[model samples]
Target chain A: MQTVKMVITGPFSSGKTEFIRTVSEIDVVATERKISSEVEKIKESTTVAMDFGRITVDDDLVLFLFGTPGQKRFDFMWEILSEGMLGFIVMVDSTRPETFREARTILETFKAYAPTPYIVAANKQDSPDAWEVEDVKHALRLDPEVKIMPCVARNKESVKTVLLELLYGILAEMEKN
Target chain B: MALKGNLRDFTITQLLNLVNLARKTGSLIIEGPTDVAQVTFRDGKLAFARLGQTDSSLATILHLNQKITAGQYRVIKERAGKMTDKELGLLLINAGYLSQEDILGSVQQYFIAIIRQLYTWVDGFFRFQPDLMPPEDKITVRLDLENLIIEGSRQMKEQEQLQEEIPSLDMALKFSERPGTNLRNVSLSVEEWRVVSYINPKNTIRQIAKANKMNDLAIRRVVFSLLQAGLVQLARPEGMPVAPVTSSSSSRPGAAPLPVTNKEEQKSLVNRLISRIRSL
Candidate 1:
């Protein structure tokens, strides 16, 4: 069977795992551990290693979703997971402005890794305090051409929309070549 | 719901930029380590600010600016106790004690000073209360935030550069092994010398910063200069978490790079993925 890979990355607790789990047809394989740092106060556990999920598009095509570990120390795994991926998504917790810088860093790192199409998923858009997608784009200093889509990661429809937008970006890149 | 977050994540500059760009009218209440500040904005312009429990009364401000004498200040404080700042200002203007320009200028200066003090506060919790206006009893002024935003942006850029150079405070520092460029030969500032004395393989930069009573920006600046001078080098502190590893190359070891796909193959794959997602 032919398979394609897409990596999901962002800062700590930016909903990488949830994004993958929502759309993955198979049960996600997550290596989550109880967070021991001060971050534990925010969430009980975090992805320590990586989260794996899969989608069988059809009998002839399949897609693999890889979620990178978000903490700074786990940064080494980003390059490993990003290798040979067709595209990627940089997720941001829309309610948290502090994680914006880290999100930008991750975006830049991934861009440097490969000349691939990508999109920024502004997760947690359902939160009342969540920043607008335009504000997030401005804060991240993203180009106007780069799509920053509002996303509620837990919603299957929203996750599907983000994935479809990314596929369109890839298709455009292919047509350009 | 009110907009709120830690200052460490969204900075004052970013907050100001958002307010300016969005033309927001609100009160941004910031709770610093030891004090709380409330700065009100009108259509993105700075309208008023109060820091902690400081005296921000109109009479006090006028007196501080020498627009009113000490005797007048005391008399106003004792007799105009129940009168609002607007009422008191009108009375003063009618009695020829001060002009409108005098009162507004002094208040604006005071508010700007409070905002300048807030620029130094890197760690705090801030919330923006939408359409929260200053008390009617207090005086307010509309001062353009463009200049303040520009200055704050400059400061933020400098701080960001320093952080980029020294990404982590958990890492320790050691004297460089170069035969030349010793500390004795270099002329170091008092602050630099203070930081230099604390450099060691076991003492993390955070410890050094705490010992010297320096904040994150201050400590990063000192360490960045030392690194530039080749006087110190970063080292992982004993038993500390591993520092981030940055890869200069496209792919890291142990991860086999994917073979490049041709345009036709990529297009077909994307078309198939799109079709699947659209169907979902």
Candidate 2:
């Protein structure tokens, strides 16, 4: 089977684990109760640091999906974790608009280290008051060619739609080569 | 066999069973890793998922393939139990244990867990959509009333005469229109199309590669082409297949109003960064 590596990089509790759970073809084996209470007082548990899964787009190919730590302190670790990585799904929360810069920094870092393609999933599109898709793009200053999809990370439909977009982005990148 | 209420009160496996039986649509929101994940379902079939804010510069995820110890995983859960997903992702990323790519990968997997559990929870007791918002972190999803009493009695008699109708893989595949695609004329390399054909909407790439001797990388390239062309898709795994007859839910009085908790948490860490920015 041909495999491509993709990573799920986002803030803590931004549905990294859940995203992995829903898109992977097989059942994901998660470490139950993987968290610290003291941390809980500061944050949420459920999927503390990271999660893993894979997607089969067809009979011959599979994407090795990776999720990273949700905390900023873990940023230094990404260089090591992202070696030979194909692309990334930058999970964003439209509910909170202040995080635009943080997302940009990570993308800039990627550009500096590796010229990889990426797609943005403006999650929580289900929320009644989510920022407009255009507003998000304007805020993030993303490229028009980049596929930034509207989605509710909780819904498989929305998730699938975005996956197709990112996969396309990956293919587009490969085509450029 | 029936499925019941939302998964806030049930385990992962339990939730998936409910999804399969109801053939419901919408998304299940799981508050894991400090973020709210929405996994969409149609006719109780798995659809798609995403994480983080598409608009933000701070938005990132884990590599998804890195395996963690139950203990370290516990620390994340405990920390995220209190903090918001954004807070947690930033915390870990800054802490230097995970990368943005890695987090994205994990976010995808966590979503799969919610989808899988929907199958396990479908035992005729409760009925609920994982996508709907619950009144509390752990609220009971009241089942449909009329069917609960009626179906309970009917099950005893029906079991004697009924043989469980199992759906074939092809039938389940029908849930996705396959985009009614024709792969011809596309600029596919022999290696790329070989990989693309393997990335069926229904199976995982790992599963496909296991069946064939192809390297996962080649297949991934093709899958990307199909995805770009809108011919195939990737979704969380729905539970085991069942017959055409969907399940029922119990009737509960109108749901109580959910408590107001600030969905967004304080960006203290980032706040510090922001403050530093302003000072600069």
Candidate 3:
């Protein structure tokens, strides 16, 4: 089967790993490390390396998903991971209004490195304080052509919708190219 | 005689508590695998901290925390050439980016953060130099070492438990055939949910850790807690080969047969790691 690399990336706690975990047919491989800093107050560990997962779609094609570490210190991992990627997904945590800038930074970094078709998944939309899709779009300063899908990453259906949206985007980009 | 020893012979936690309780004034210098750190104590309180090259600069921390933008960081870096870390912090305050209190708070946090990382090291050498004061020019942030000892020890215990429970990185995780006996009250965290979702019979703890962008210790802790909750169990014994799931040209090569857990093997690993650190 032909294999395509797809990257899922975002800032801290944006649900990139969770999204991949939700969709991956195979078990996801991750390199999580204990966070010694104040970030540990929020979460026990952070991704220092990359997250890997795979899905076999039909007999003809396979999708390999790689999730980048959220911190800048691991930006080198992004460079290594984005190589030969078909497309990518950028997730934004809607509830973390302050993190929009970081998410934008991640999106820009991915675009610069991959230059492939991509869509933004505004995750954690189920949270009470989660920004509206429109608000997230505004916060991220996304272009009109860019698709922003609000998703609850923990939900299988929601994660599937996000993946399908990216797949369609990839297909469209491939056709254009 | 000055107190000095390898960490294998003396626990850092005990040393910290001993100094704190004694109300000693000294600098505890710890040399780890790659870098060295000095923790200055004044009458039992952690007066200040200094670390070797591996420690991230204040600007880097600020940038990472998103307190400063990339442009601002570059400008700060260019402008603060030759300035000490303390001076750079003061500059941040003078530039209206951070207040004095904020800078002080960050200093304390930054020191504690490095100390937290140091606490994780199983091998290192330590020396307590008596009657040495912290640098007068540096920003001094005092901490109650006893409080730090309590917190650090708790975290260390958790880490120990994780390592003890999941000794081998390659152990596979499988969900229990019987659902955890107590169901209704047990709520899972987002991380737990992610771990649970990826619990295929074939994936080892190491692979799961990699896919989740987590270290073995973190993954092991999750798996250990799940086991305690009766949510998951080990699928295979240590050193057993799970069927290789990789195709031809796969990035993952088979795990090399690990050396038996003997003193010689450990000595070899330590020597290899030290050389690796030196090369870096």
Candidate number of the best TM-score: 1
Instruction: Write down the lDDT of every candidate, Cα atoms only.
Output: 0.88, 0.52, 0.73
Candidate 1 colliding pairs:
A98-B9
Alpha-carbon error at B213 in model 3, in Å?
Answer: 10
Compute fnat per model. 0.54, 0.00, 0.00
Interface RMSD of 2: 23.2
Name the candidate, 1 or 3, with the larger DockQ value. 1
Candidate 1 at A53: error in angstroms? 2.4
Model 3, CA-based lDDT:
0.73
lDDT score at residue A104, model 1, on the 0-100 scale? 95
Stretches of candidate 2 exceeding 4 Å from the true structure: A29-43, A46-49, A57-60, B1-280
lDDT of 2 by residue, A35-83 (tens): 5656434344554345667765446555667777666655655655466
lDDT tens digits, residue span B18-113, model 2: 444445565555544334445555565554543334311112223234445556656666656565555666677898876756665565555454
Predicted candidate 3 versus true structure: per-residue lDDT over B176-237, tens digit per residue: 77854554467988777778777887788788877887654467778888999887888784
Error at B192, model 3, angstroms: 8.0
True contacts kept of 2: 0.00
Error of 3 at A78 (Å): 61
CAPRI-style grade of the A/B interface in model 2: incorrect
